[model samples]
Target: MNRPLCIAHLYPDLLNLYADKGNILTLKRRLEWRGLEAQVTLVTSSEEARPGDYDLVLLGGGSDREQEIVSRTLRRSRDEWKAAVEDGLPLLAVCGGYQLLGEYYQLPDGTKVPGLELLDMVTVAGSPRLIGNVAIESDECGTIVGFENHGGRTTHHHAPLGKVISGHGNNGTDGHEGVRYKNVFGTYIHGPLLPKNPALADFILQTALDYAGIDVKLEPLDDELEKAARTAFQVRRMNLSEVAAQTP
Candidate 1:
């Protein structure tokens, strides 16, 4: 019997603004469908993060106030997380949580919001929040689909998760969508991010399982509904782009 996959969901109460809990649900259901046992634990602001205790770590988006609170909490466990990542633990951080994984997030007023420095990247707040359905062409995970809504423009020296194919990503000027380093992934894409992109979800899960010393191949699940949802979002984005281009 395989060991149950353990996922530590950070700040489920606060950093779940964009229905990010759906990502956790997607991961759990996928594992259950494959006849694998899965466990998800919510790590709150009061709790210390023990990354070594979990196979996968998930951090979702939140409002500015909520992010500040979580940032302080994450700082307390920075060393633990750094060690865990070095040990090959997988992490999926999105939006606000993604920003917190970087060097620092600079506010519009020039205040610096400290990050965990897990990834070699920096995010600066800018005008006109990047909000829309997005598609990206990834080198490792193929095309990824999601929605992004953020004011932070992230710039990284490391390899990007993917190149933008549809909507504004990262800084809007850059064509990149997210940052990828080792087993850690940081992205601005929300839409809960996983349901419409099962491939990406599986990639994270597999990585987690691999780190857990499990070598079982994952059986494929019926992703017909998932694919259709992705296609519909892509079509909608295309239509919106066409309309914007034709206007004026």
Candidate 2:
């Protein structure tokens, strides 16, 4: 019998701006389908993040104001989180959460949002938000698809999560999409991210399981619909690119 997978969802009420709850649902359902049990604990602003109690940690996007609030809340327990990540806790942080995991994020008005310094990166907010369907070739996973919408351009000094294939990733000039540090992954893409990329989801799950000393292999599921959705998005992205090319 496989041990139950425990997931810690950080700030669900404050940081779920982009249907990020879908990520939790996707992870839980996938585990259930494979006959494995999943337990998700919502860690709010009032609660401390105990990484050792969970197999995986999830942080989602939020508004700038919410990000500030969350940042302040996290500061109280920064050492706990830092130690957790260093101990190989699997983490997935998207958009605002991604920025918060970095060194800092500078707002357009020159205000600075201090990060946990967990990842060696910085995000600077600028004009013309990168909003569109995105595709990338991840070094750890494979082809990944999602949507990106952010004015903050992230520049990382560490290994990137993936190279941009059909979207403006990171700063739009670096051709990188996200950052990967140890078992933690950060990205700007969030069509809830996981439903269309089962491979990436499984990678995260397996990594978390492995860290927990659970050696059970995840059996494959019927991903026909998931593949079709990914293909459709790829086709649409290609068409859009072609149209832009012919615009001149």
Best by lDDT: 2
**Tens-place lDDT digits, model 1, residues 44-125:** 8778878879989899999888888888888887998888887778999999999998899999999888999888889999
Model 2 lDDT vs. the true structure? 0.91
Worst 10 residues of 1 by lDDT: 212-221
lDDT of 1 at 183: 92
For candidate 2, write residues 97-154 as lDDT tens digits: 9999988899999999999989888999988999999999987789999999999999
Q: Over 4 Å off in model 2, which ranges?
A: none
Q: Which ten residues in a row have the lowest lDDT in candidate 2?
A: 43-52
Candidate 1: list runs displaced more than 4 Å. none
Please report, in order, the local distance difference test score of every candidate based on alpha carbons. 0.89, 0.91
What TM-score does candidate 1 get on C-alpha atoms? Answer: 0.97
